[model samples]
Each structure stands twice: as structure tokens, then as C-alpha cells.
Target: MGEDLTYLSFRVIDKKGRAHILEITLDTNYPKCPPSISADVPHIFNLDWSGNSKLKDAVVQFEHHVDKLQDFWSTLDDIDRSLWVVDPKDPHFAMSYRQINIGNDCYITLSVNASDPRSLPQCRFLGSDANVNLLRRKWKINCKRWVKDRSFSENLTSILDIELPQPPEVRKDDRQTECGVCYAQYLPIDDELGSKSGSATDYTCENNNCSRAFHSVCLRDWLRSITTTRRSFDVLFGNCPYCSNPVAVKIINKK
Candidate 1:
């Protein structure tokens, strides 16, 4: 009676939008020995093939009526489509919202390469120097909780709800502040009138995590190392070394 039957491989997304890779193989002695079903997501399906009559009955049903198995998979797919909303505007839609805004001017941008739901998404923070540092620290503290939950939407919600330390007060005399890049205290340049130039030490990173003031010369040198100049003009555009956010620096024209 056993004529021809082959194994089936399926890739499916669950209600949570997590993909599950599965393989169902009908044994040569199928009805006598239950079919083997293996899945990448162990929680979704488990088999007890230890001489269980129910297992044999299930396999026989699957063999006799393949539609039942297909129906089960289709149900999961439908559930996935209904629950997972992939919209860029919705912060709760993790797959769609690549950049998450958690108020306080803080942002967490997900890496495009992060496709696995089980793995923590590689992300970087953007904001004022203070907020960036605050978010980064928070992320480090709660990353394991996200992994345990394995729900992107839940993770986003929790991060946004977390309370962070108050941003430190801005220093009035930041002229002699140490440069975040060069690690040297800023020194004002002399003006034509032989007075300290106010703008000389004003080049501070806009990133909330790094309000470190830098000499224009030092900043230019640092920016140049990370980017190439444009063909027509000496302009460099790149992410901040600390935050990986867009930054543009132009070569100062010497008179």
C-alpha cells in the first residue's frame, strides 16, 4: 500500500512574526513508526515518538490527510499576518520601525542585518550627549530581559517606559573642557586683537552623550581620518564616532 511519499520542508512565520524552519519526514515504515517532525523553534512543536499509540494515530492521519497538516501551518501564517503590523509610523511595530524614538530626544536605530528575533538586535543610540549615554546604559542593563521576552514590541515598550537619570547640568565654563575625541582640554585661539576667540573652543559634539568641547583643529583632524573629501570640495560626511549618527564637517578655508 505504501507507494510514494516524500519529506516536506516548510519555512513559516509565527503569530509573533518569528520565522520557524521545519522538516517533516515520513519514515519508510511510516504508519508503524511515527513521522519525524523537526523544527528550528522548539517551542512550537514537540514530538514524543516513544511507542505512543496517539503518535501513530497522528502520523497516520497526517499521511492519510495531508490537508490537516497544511491547515495547521496556514493557521499559524494567518495568525502572524493579523498580529504583526509592519508599519514604520507605529513604534510598536518592531519589524517596520527601524528607528525607535523613546522620548527625551533619545533614539535607538536597529541594524538592518538583525533578522533573528531570538538574538538581541544590534542597535546604536542617538541624541544629545546626555540622553545617548543614558539610553546606552539602560540598554546594557535591560538587554537580557529583552532576550528573555523575545518580543520586540514588548521590548520597545519597556525601554520607553524606563526612567533614566536626569541629564547633567551644562557647564557655563566649557572652554577648557577636555575634547571627547583628542582627550585634551580645549585652548582658545588668539584673535587679531590678541584676545581669546569665543568660537575657538565652541566646537562641541551635538550628541547628548558627548558635550565635550574640542578645538576646531582637533575636530577637523578627527573627522578627516574617518571620511574622504568630496571630489569638488573638501567636505566630510560621516557618523559621530561615539554615536554613529550623521555628521558633516567642512574644511576651513585659510585666508
Candidate 2:
């Protein structure tokens, strides 16, 4: 059994088609003998991720099945090791677990390391082939299940099925000549321009309660100045001079 169980190897492929290899060496007299079976018998040979992207974009999952050694494995006697890249500059890294065991029939571990060139974490396992195989099969099944359910169309259809609220209608009135900003009557202009002339002030921000009135030239200058100052042309700037409340600015053509 010693020579037969000397080494074990496994490969991992991430969603992005990156491959990683893991190798472990087994001691026939593990945990029982001292010198031959070193305390660190189950060592993590290699734990790494592929792809040009860093490990942060990767995830690893493991499951262990130790049926005959359930009691020993379940007692948390097994060592847990981790592999990580310590240097901020390194691209790949690995870690190992000494011993670990959970109460479940099998131990399933899932890990996701955030992308940071400063730190990259990886996964590990210390168990028999049977245990590794069990875990690998389950991982494969879960991956297939996930791929089948991933879709945006299903979500969009659900949203489209829901009823939407109606929007309010807009009305226009021309009977009154009002300042575009304050919506106040254009200050009565001198009759020199005639009855159709209305107010010489061409436009105002139509907020009904504002008082600011401007000749088209004056308003244009104000707008240009505001634009140069990087101020928004929105109502949040304050109402026109004629109105106390917020007002909308509008441009009217005198022609």
C-alpha cells in the first residue's frame, strides 16, 4: 500500500477555462508512526489558478468522503491548510491545511478570493482517493446545474409581465403672455412696440411665483455666465426674480 498510494494528482478548470493542478503525497503509516509519518504527512503540493486574470476572479469547491474513518475525520482531527500568494506582485499562489473534519457525511468547502495582486488565496484537501472522487463528482453536478439556470431572458420576461403605471399628460396655453421663469405677466411694456408686441421681455423662467424679468439679451448673458461657472440649468438654482418658488426658464423668439 505504501508504494501504491505514494502520490495523487488532480486538475481544476475555472469558468474562464483556466487550469490548476494539485498534487499530494501519502504516507502509508500516516498519524501512527513518528519519523516515517511526519506530523505534516498530508502536504499541499500545488494549488494555483490559470488565466491572465488574477485568482480573485476564481472560485474553488471541495468535498471529502472518508467513510471508514468517519469518526476520526468527523472529530476535527484532520489538519486544514491554505495556499495563498503573500507578495502583492506575485500572480499565483497556493496554501495547505494540516487536518480538518466536519460532522456531515461529507465535507464540502467553497472558497472565493477577491482579486488583489497584494493577496491571492487558494484551496486544498488532505484525504483518500475515494473522498476526493466523491467531492469532484458533486462539484461537477453543481456546475452543470448552475449553467442551465443562468439567463437574463427569464428575468426580463418576468418584469415585462407586471403592470406599469400611466404617466401624466402635458397641456399648453397661449392666452396669457407670461415670463418663462416666473410665469408672471410680462411687465407691461411701453406701447411703442404696439398691441401685438406684448412685453419686450421675450422669455422668463415660468415659475409662477418668481419676479426676475430679463430682456432676451439679459437672460442669454445670465445663462452664458451660469454655464461658464459650471452651474446646472436646472430649477435647483432658484426661482426667477418674479416668483418666490422654483421656476423653469424658457426661451421665446420675438420674431
lDDT per residue (tens digit) for residues 142-255 in model 2: 333322132212221232232212112213342234544334555445454344244545544442212234554344444433322223543224223222223334433444
**Across residues 1-255, which tens digit of lDDT does each residue of candidate 1 receive?**
223545765544332222334566778775567677754331323354645454444444333333223323332222222222222331211231255454566666754321233345678777899878877877787776664333455565565456433324446564337665656564455453133243445466554433446666666666655423222377655544433334556666543
lDDT of 1: 0.47
Compared to the true structure, candidate 1 yields what TM-score?
A: 0.31
Taking all chains together, each candidate's TM-score versus the true structure is 0.31, 0.19
Q: What is the C-alpha lDDT of each candidate?
A: 0.47, 0.31
RMSD of 1: 20.9
Clash-forming residue pairs, model 1? 128-207, 128-208, 128-209, 129-207, 129-208, 129-209, 129-210, 130-208, 130-209
Q: In candidate 2, which residue ranges exceed 4 Å CA deviation?
A: 1-163, 174-177, 180-183, 187-197, 200-221, 228-255
